[model samples]
Target: MAVQSLQAAPVPVTAAGRRRDREAMIAFWLFMSPMLLGLIVFTFVPIVWGFLLSFSRAQNTVSVGDFIGFQNYVDVLRDREFRRSLITILVFTAFIVPLTYAASLGLAMLVNGVNWGRGIFRTAFFIPTAISYVVASLIWRMSLFNGIPSGVANIAIYEWFGIENPINWIAGTDPPWYWLVLVTVRLWLQVGFYMIIFIAGLQEIPRSLYEAAWVDGARSGWTTFRDITLPMLRNTTIAVMLLLFINAFQAFDEFFNVLGGTAATQGNRGLARPPLVYLYQVAFQDADYGRGSAGAFILTAIIITVTVVQGRLFGFGRSA
Candidate 1:
């Protein structure tokens, strides 16, 4: 009998502790109620309404008419403008997402390594995120890429480099130089926001991993980055890419303002009219609300389908 003694099991939580937790949970939900209410009322309600309206034969989006089944969806599917708009968005996304991802990551790496004035650099980069698409487009259109020979871009290429002809950036469709104007402004506006996100992700990675790699005779910086840093940033990269995809799909303000000019004097929208712009024209301008709503749902489906496929491929929610 070698001092056979039974060890006590783990102590149960006190009633007071349980009560405190319950109270804390109540307080949390109480605080969250307002935000939840707002989301339901403003966002969810409108979404549900829009879905319903898509199936209806509504002339103006607000006033609902008789239900027309899937006719509206069928019409929008057959519409050439809608199909073209989808292709334009795909083209835009192909250009913008990769450029933004590379730019932001490079910027983040640079900012992270800076020995001094890091805050200043971060602030300077992030400042552009606060600028509205409307304002940025105006600056690009009215000053930078105004298409005139005296414009900033024209002056840079023609005067500084002594090029014979100033390129008509906006109006020129042959070379598709207008893409430069759109892409540049979007990059300037959004890169800072994504860069900050990358910086946060970079900071979250453990310094010990680099030290361990170094101890294991990994002398090359690029090797350490490839093996440790990139692998560690899987989640952040997935999130950033997903957001980039969604935002790219939602692009409208800059396109409309820069290309079309003012509301009173709309430009040639036939060139690069995205789905949102097409929907806007259909809904508000043309008052074909049912078709517009159908287009909206179609676009939503495309976004959702892409997101689901990507999430699956990336193993977004799975354990590492």
Candidate 2:
């Protein structure tokens, strides 16, 4: 009998290999440099500068004078408009997040179940996401939700249903009718994107689990989905919710385009103006850079805090 001894051979690195590796690293970095540079220049620098401006007294946003040290923040926090705008955003987020989430999840489920033309349906739904917010808002305002009886919404309510008057969907704040417009536009523009995310998450779930459930007489689709699909999609759901919350908070273009008009009077501005709209008026209209910057930071903090709380509650990235 013979015993064999095994020796591990080391991987050989030639001089040419080392040179190629170095060159590859250099080339990779070269490819990345433009994007890295753009991020630093456009995103990072603006964020840092905005933070600094928040603490300073800048009238025109250009000449930063005297570090007033939180005066701007205090002023912004105490401002009625700022407080009101933030509150409005909170209310909007409360509604839009849930509605969008449910709608997207339902749409994803429907799209996932389709045996044919899945891509066509997904692309059809996702087409709205590509539409510019301004254009969508304009279409919603001018064509769909227009105050006149000729508008689609008014026609449905007033003509088809035989209501006496055409309700002003955006302008009427008596029952907060404007919320209907806001919520609908947001759902139309965003649900498709989130639906795609949900679809991706749904696809990752194994078919074997569903089959096993079916074998166990969990043949009811709703039962299987509730017991299996939702639980499996927990992290994905959390991510979608977080993103929805952020998007809701950052709502500006639609609100601005719909509500903000040529007349910049306080009377013209309605109740649904979000924080960004308020900040926009402050910075651009009133030329209050310091306050605007403070408002920006305050909104950012609110977004981060909400996200962290949600992540904690949902046990995101945590094992079962």
Candidate 3:
């Protein structure tokens, strides 16, 4: 009887221990309830719904509709306009990412070199980042590249270079050149944001490394940059590249505002039309919800794939 009692005593204790752990877990879950609820409502719910919607024919007004299997995706694949838009988006990303990185790195270097008013310089560079995409697009359209003699670019061209006529930088369909204008405006708008990122990355880098490089007699700019700055900035560089690529691919506002939605300008000739814009046209303008949803999903897939590829190629988050 004594042995039986002792053996039975541990069972109750173990049961009590398990109950205590269960209660603690319940409390922890309660603590996290609000955040979990918010994530479900805002993020997870939307993502799941969007994915489901991609397979259906639901419009913005209608919540649910007939399931169309792979018809939506098939239509998108066969769509020439959608294909063109995808290519345009890719081209835009290709141009903007490298340009943004180079410009941001240069701006960061410039700010870092300054002995006084570094804050002011940093703020000035970041001011554009504070502006919304719509506001910035409007500003660029009206004030900077307005395409008239009174416009900034035109005025500068006429006064400084003595060119008679102001060129319509955004209106022309000339292959590479119109693309250049779009890319330049995008670069001007985006460089500041990336500059801030680069500045932060640069600041985090230890001064000891540079001191060591100096001690090693690495006085040349190329050698020091290649050996010290580039290696140290690898993670930051990957982040900047990813951000620039995503922003470039998802670009819509500037293109939409600058290149208004006339059918003539909808094709490859127009600078403003990216995949998102085309998707917007199909979903909103034409009311082809199924096709639009498919395009959106395809675009999302492309972004995910490209980001993964970039991560693999650049080894992001793998090292310090």
Instruction: Please identify model 3 stretches exceeding 4 Å from their true place.
Output: 1-34, 59-65, 175-177, 261-272
TM-score of each: 0.89, 0.92, 0.84
lDDT of 3 by residue, 1-320 (tens): 87786773443558789998799999999999999999999989877776777788876544646898988899888988788888888878878887788998999989988999999998888887767777766677678877788988889889899998878767765533456557777787778888888888888888898888888888848898888888888998999888888888888887886675456545533454788888888888788777787888899999999999999999987966
Best prediction by lDDT: 1
Cα deviation in Å at residue 38, candidate 2? 1.0
State the lDDT of candidate 2 residue by residue for 14-61, as single tens digits: 998789789999999999999999999999998988888888888876
Query: What ordering of candidates by TM-score runs from best to worst?
Result: 2, 1, 3
Model 3 steric clash pairs: none
Q: How good is model 2 by TM-score?
A: 0.92
What's the distance in Å from true for residue 208, model 3?
Answer: 2.6
lDDT, model 3: 0.80
**What C-alpha lDDT do the candidate models reach, one value each?**
0.90, 0.87, 0.80
Tell me the tens digit of each residue's lDDT in model 1 across 1-320.
34545655455699987997799999999999999999999999988888888889988556665799999999999999899999999999999999999999999999999999999999999999999999999999889998788899999998678986878888789898889999999999999999999999999999998888889999747898899888888999999999999999999988898888456766657778889998998888889888888899999999999999989999998876
Q: Cα deviation of 38 in candidate 3 (Å)?
A: 3.3
lDDT of 2 at 61: 61
